[model samples]
Target: MLLNQFLVLGAALFAFGVYGLLVRRNVVLILLSVELMLNAVNINLIAFESYLVSAQAVGQVFAIFVITVAAAEVGIGLAIVLMIFRNRKSANVDDLSLMRW
Candidate 1:
């Protein structure tokens, strides 16, 4: 209901996302964690727009932009992960060192 509540929820989501990103080795789970973080950002943006900002739609527009970017990110991220899986026969991030050579 309140802006602070939304902010707390967003923070919690972001924290979980970060923890998942750091702990998970699978590319797919990492991508999902990234999506979680992005959603948290979107929540914060909308909350701020609704509570702090003026009547302008700037926050909503930014939120939309974030959503668009997140969608593209998921598409490209999944494609890259799929290719990696196909070539490496594994989806583990630790196995991604082949690109360094």
Candidate 2:
């Protein structure tokens, strides 16, 4: 019962994070939402591992990978945002419309 509840909650969080990422325009906020989604996924992975099996290390390993990937993604994203801001003098997505046309 409790496991199912946790799973559902984790799923909900992941869904909301994805929605926020798609809906938000700010680069920094999008990165934050991505982090939230990754965390929610990690929660689900760890929870299922702990509840379904005796081997706890696999989920932990994957969670560590996710964290590492998220950190790298954020670093790259921030660098790109800074570069874009420097070139365009703004961070707003609407400002980037110039690049499209």
Candidate 3:
């Protein structure tokens, strides 16, 4: 209910996302972790927007932008991942070396 509670929940979600991003080796899982981080940011934005009671709803607007960007990112990311998986037959991040000469 309180602002601090929302903030703490957001922080916790962000922390978990960071941990997953660092520890996961699968590309899909990495993408999911990124989504989690973005969701955490959204939660924080909404919480602040509600707490501030602003007329412009700036935080919510920014959150919407973030969501839009995240969606685009997921689309592009999955496309790349799908291509890589088709070529290599695995979705593990450690297996990707297409950037190297």
Candidate with maximal lDDT: 3
Which wins on TM-score, candidate 2 or candidate 3?
3
lDDT, candidate 1, at 65: 98
State candidate 1's TM-score: 0.92
Candidate 2 to truth, TM: 0.89
CA lDDT of 16 in candidate 2? 91
- By lDDT, highest first, what's the ranking? 3, 1, 2
lDDT of 1 at 93: 89
Model 2 lDDT tens row, 13-98: 99999998999888888888999999999998888878876565788788899999999999999999999999988877767886
Q: Which stretches of candidate 2 lie over 4 Å from their true place?
A: 54-56, 99-101
Better of 1 and 2 by TM-score: 1
Whole-model Cα lDDT per candidate?
0.95, 0.88, 0.96
Worst 10 residues of 2 by lDDT: 48-57
Candidate 1 CA-lDDT value = 0.95
Which run of 10 residues does model 3 get worst, by summed lDDT? Answer: 92-101
lDDT of 1 by residue, 1-101 (tens): 78899999999999999999999999999999999999999999999999977677899999999999999999999999999889889999898886686
Clash pairs, model 2 backbone: none
- The Cα RMSD of model 3 versus the native structure comes to 1.5
